[model samples]
Target chain A: EAEVAQSPRYKITEKSQAVAFWCDPISGHATLYWYRQILGQGPELLVQFQDESVVDDSQLPKDRFSAERLKGVDSTLKIQPAELGDSAMYLCASSFGFNYGYTFGSGTRLTVV
Target chain B: EDKVVQSPLSLVVHEGDTVTLNCSYEVTNFRSLLWYKQEKKAPTFLFMLTSSGIEKKSGRLSSILDKKELSSILNITATQTGDSAIYLCAGATAGTALIFGKGTTLSVSS
Candidate 1:
């Protein structure tokens, strides 16, 4: 089974520090998504990418957060001057086609101290 | 804004019991409804329904979509402890991203 891959299964950082997470979607999957999930809440969409272009990032905090899928295959999400409230699990998902079911990665759990 | 809502945020049952999870949505250009099972790590795809009146089934799990009401239900039969986890529902729209519901946490005890 082709699975989406994520790096740094867990990360701990001091407040105001920088953190970065990486994700590689399944091959041939054109749609990639980044989501933030709190302990008891469902995953919230942070950004969506389609073939190296951002389709939606309305919920992303541009001031401190940024995500890029340069070649449209792999993506990186970075947070500068992270805050305590930023602690959560970051999940990456992808689908071969739009409007289809998504396959998710194991996720990177970030803890901002 | 597109929205998805799930019911009975938490549920607890014993083995061999039957349980039903609900999901409702209000989305623009609604395309399909999907269900996923989340354990300790990543969520696994369970089912996807794009048409109404047709039920999708896999082993002990089955799901149906009601386009007229914009809702869906996931039914689990002969549940086991392994079924304890969060079940999520997401509504996908054409030319847009998916809108996810809060999810229902099911705990099936022995």
Candidate 2:
């Protein structure tokens, strides 16, 4: 079965540093989602994309976080001047559409020191 | 706001035992309910329940949704140690986004 791909399985950075995570959805999937999972908590949506356009990002902290899916195939999420509270697991998922079967990547574990 | 609540927070079982996990939701324009298994990193999809009473099954795992009751149940039979993981329940509305519950941690010992 095809799987969503993510890079930099783990990352550690200083509080004031910048960090980025990448995700490549399964081939042919048009809907992509980025979610953050804090320890002992369920994953929360950070952003959603339909092809290359963003559809929802209501909970994303625009002040320090930005995500882009420029090509409609893959995506990138970045956090500038990271804060300690930013430490968490970033997961990428995709599906054919909003209500289709979803697939998730292993995710990137970020730690802001 | 959409909300999902899972019961019993955690469970401990021995190999060969059967276990049932519960998920209840309260959301507008309900579309579907999903169950996922999270081991260490990302959550892997297990079952998606769209209609009530029609059970979705794969091997020893089965799930059913009761639209009237607003709840769902996941059943795992002849459990093995490999079944140990965190189980998450989520509710999806008319839109694409899903509202997730905290999840239940299940540990299967030999």
Candidate 3:
């Protein structure tokens, strides 16, 4: 089975530092999603991309977070001046279309000091 | 706002026991319901429920969606230690991202 790929399996950064995570969705998947999972809680959507265009980012903290998928295949999410509260497991997922089951990557665990 | 809620935040069962997980949702234009199992890292897809009154099953696991009640249930029979994990439930919207519930943590001990 094809799996979504994510980089930086673990990361620890100081507050005020910049960090970025990358994800490569399964081939042929057109919808990619970025989600943040806090300890003891479920994953929350940070952003959603359809091909190369952003479909929804209502919950994303625009002031400090930004994501882009230039080629509509791989995506990058960056957080500038990371804060302690930003520490969480960042998960990437992709699907072939609406209502399709999503496949999640291994995820990047971020720890801010 | 779209939301999914799960009950019994945590559960403990012995091997061979049967467990049931509950999920309720209040999402606009609800498209589908999804179940996933998380063990340390990310969540792995388990089931996708799209039609009411239809049950989806795999091995010892089964799930049913009730659109009329806006709820779903996941059943795991003959559970083993390996079945211990955080089970997440999510509600997918028609044109937006999925909204996940807090999840139910199940620990099956042998």
lDDT of each: 0.92, 0.92, 0.94
Candidate 1 residues B16-98, lDDT tens each? 99999999999998888989999978889999888643489999999999988989999999999999999999988886577
Model 1 per-residue lDDT at B74: 98
Specify the highest-DockQ model's number.
3
Would you list the rank order by TM-score, best first? 3, 1, 2
Of the pair 1 and 2, which is ahead by TM-score?
1
- Native-to-model Cα distance after best TM-score fit, residue A7 in candidate 3, in Å: 0.6
Best by TM-score: 3
Q: Indicate the docking level reached by candidate 1.
A: medium
- B71-103: candidate 3 lDDT, tens digit per residue: 999999999999999999999889847899999
lDDT of 1: 0.92
Native contact fraction per model:
0.70, 0.78, 0.89
Candidate 1 segments whose C-alpha is farther than 4 A from its true place:
none
- Candidate 1 pairs with clashing backbones: none
- The lowest-lDDT stretch of 10 consecutive residues in candidate 3 chain B is B46-55
Displacement of the residue B24 alpha carbon in candidate 1, Å: 0.7
Candidates 2 and 3 compared: the better one by DockQ is 3
My TM-score estimates for the predictions, one after another, are 0.97, 0.96, 0.98
- Cα error, residue B104 of model 3, in Å, equals 0.2
Candidate scoring better on DockQ of 1 and 2:
2
lDDT of 3 at B10: 99
